[model samples]
Target: MRRLLVLGAGTAGTMVVNRLRPRLPRDEWEITIVDQSEVHHYQPGYLFVPFGTYEPEEIVKPRRRLIKDGVRQLTGVIEEVVTDAHLVRLADGTELPYDQLVIATGTHPNPDETPGLAEPEAKQRGVHSFYTLEDAVALRDAMERFDGGRLVVNLIDLPIKCPVAPLEFAFLAEAWLRERGLRERTEVTYVTPLDGAFTKPLAARELGGMFDERGIALQPDFMLERVDLDEQQLVSYDEREVPFDLLVTVPLNMGAAYVARSGLGDELNHVKVDKHTFLADGHDDIFAIGDAANLPTSKAGSVAHFAVDVFVDNVLRHVEGLPMQERFDGHANCFIESGDGKAMLLDFNYETEPLLGSFPLPEIGPLKLLGESEANHLGKLAFRWIYWHLLLPGRPLPLATSMSMVGKRRPPAPSGNGSSTSPRDLQEVSL
Candidate 1:
């Protein structure tokens, strides 16, 4: 029997195993999944944890519960991937050989990349991050004690997981403080390296306005050079300083160290894969999906979900010696929580930027695009159920793998005076 080894049991890897389990002939193929941790985290829930909106118990589950019965589960630290030999070395010195390999190892925080950012004083003195479960729990404690002060949410660098999460945190914190009757005393600031609220033009415009409406200060283009725990401030490379009583930072995220040890990844340790097929370039019988794969798209759960849909079909085709029919189009969609029981949804692909309209269905969508509504917030809350049931189980979603542009409204043609027709068109445009 041929062996199919899947690395990491996160969102992408879990979906891959579940999607392929019933398709591959059990008599001829053996599937094995590897990860260092046995617990599965609902990463999206991390954003809500600090605000007491989601409990720790609600976001975690056993990895084994999500895996199929026949699939083998191996929990250990991966030392390296010997691509040429089709083998993987574990920290315990055991080696597993495979006929096909899938690398879904996700990214994690690299606080050490920034000097003094991970120091003990920073952790003890109200400096917190909500990327991990531990960070969320610590942040909750910090928030509970904070009566009123400068609460700064800073992004250390780009390419972090769930890029919109920091903004969401700022919005949620605003609402949280208001509920506590501390909005008048608390000063909330969102510090980002990007010139605006988001990478997308339309989103930046809409979200930027939301920040203004919620009385959240926007400090754009602040590239963090280092954190001054002594002064309780974040220093930018440009010499600009933002002081804070509570610091919530999104530190730099990097891929697993094994990818670097194997000489199989980029400087970031993210595997280089074909953007369309997710097949690892220059290596046969190897594929990568999720944040581990270096695709020019948002490193979010939705992107991983869409990639697995294409990857599963391609894997099935490869085993049958047939041409792979599916192709990943850099599809990504996200729901931006705008606080006050409202949220906004966005849908786009590699070739097209996010447009304004509706999602799931172009004209008749229950969710609006580039617009905030209570329904969108409901959709975000309902996703936890879908994640545990449909997403992890690799069931087909109602949405397409590739982003659909049917229901979106395109920017109006530029009129006279070097200005566009719509206010949203004036924002930054990226494809």
Candidate 2:
């Protein structure tokens, strides 16, 4: 049987095996997935852990349990990818040859990359991170003991998984403190390197307003230099410092080292792949998906799900010696929790920003885009179920893989006065 080897049984890899197993003839092709560990994490659930909404057990599952019946699963730490030899080397010196390869090893928190943000720093100061299950649980314990202080939610840098999570954490912490009658006593600040609350101006303005309304200060353009244990402050390279009594931070995010060693990665070690096709540069037989790929889009599970849909089709076409017909548009949808049983949905692709509108069905949607509502909150809560049951299984979702502008109201061109009269742009549309 022709070998179809996969590296990393994470979000993208597992779904690949599941979606393509039945499609690829078992007699002609054999599928195998490899990972360094047996444990699989429901990563998005990590966000709610600090608030005690989810437990570690609820978000953890065995990787093997998620794999399809026909696919073989192996546990091995990836050492390197020998593209010239068409083989993958493991830590134990075993080399697995592959006719076709898929790299799905996602990004991870690299605290060591930042000076004074490593183990010693965390141990000395009250530094905490909620990126991992253990980190989330630890942060929960830290938060439980935190009665009133400068609660800082800091993002060390950008291109992190679930980019909105820092904002979510700040919001949740505010609500949590308010619920405990400590809101007035505590000061919450969101420190981000980005210019505003988010990368996009429209969303940033909206979110920044929310922060102001909640009494949370936004410290934008604060590039972190180091964590100052003595002063209990986050010091930026420019000498600006944000002090904190309780520090919650997201350190530098980096891709797997194997990608770098294999010469398939950029400076950050994320695999260099075509943004649209996800095929590795100079290698048609190799592909990178999910956070492992150096795409211009957000490194999110939603993006992976959408991209996997297109990727599955493309992989089949390639295997059959046919041209890939589909192109991924970097479509992403983020459900932003605004606290107090309210959430907002933002849907956009590479070209368009999230517009305020009714989604899926115009004016009749159960979900609203770029606006806060109870219905959107319910949708966000319901997604956890869909993630486990549908998304991971590679089953069809009601949402379109490519972003649709059907329900959204675009901003009309400049109107009135000497302005080039046209419809208002989506940026001008109020939430």
Point to the candidate with the largest TM-score: 1
Residue 372's lDDT within candidate 1 is 87
Return the lDDT, model 2, position 150: 95
TM-score of 1: 0.94
Indicate which candidate wins on lDDT: 1
Q: On residues 1-431, what C-alpha lDDT tens digit does candidate 2 reach at each position?
A: 89999999888998999999999999999999999989989999998998899888988888877888999999999999999999999999999999989999999999988877785657447899999888899888988888898999999987898898898888888988999999999999999998789997667767988999999999888999998888888999999989998999997889999999999999888999989999999998999999999999899999999999999999999988899999999999989998998989889889988777868834446587777889887887888888888888888788889998877875454355423222453235321
Quick one: RMSD of model 2? Answer: 4.2
Over 66-146, each residue of candidate 1 has an lDDT whose tens digit, in order, gives 988889999999999987788999999989999999999988999998877889788887789999999999999989999
lDDT score at residue 17, model 1, on the 0-100 scale: 94
What is the lDDT for 50 in model 1?
A: 88
Point out the worst 10-residue segment of candidate 2 by lDDT.
418-427
lDDT of 1 at 347: 88
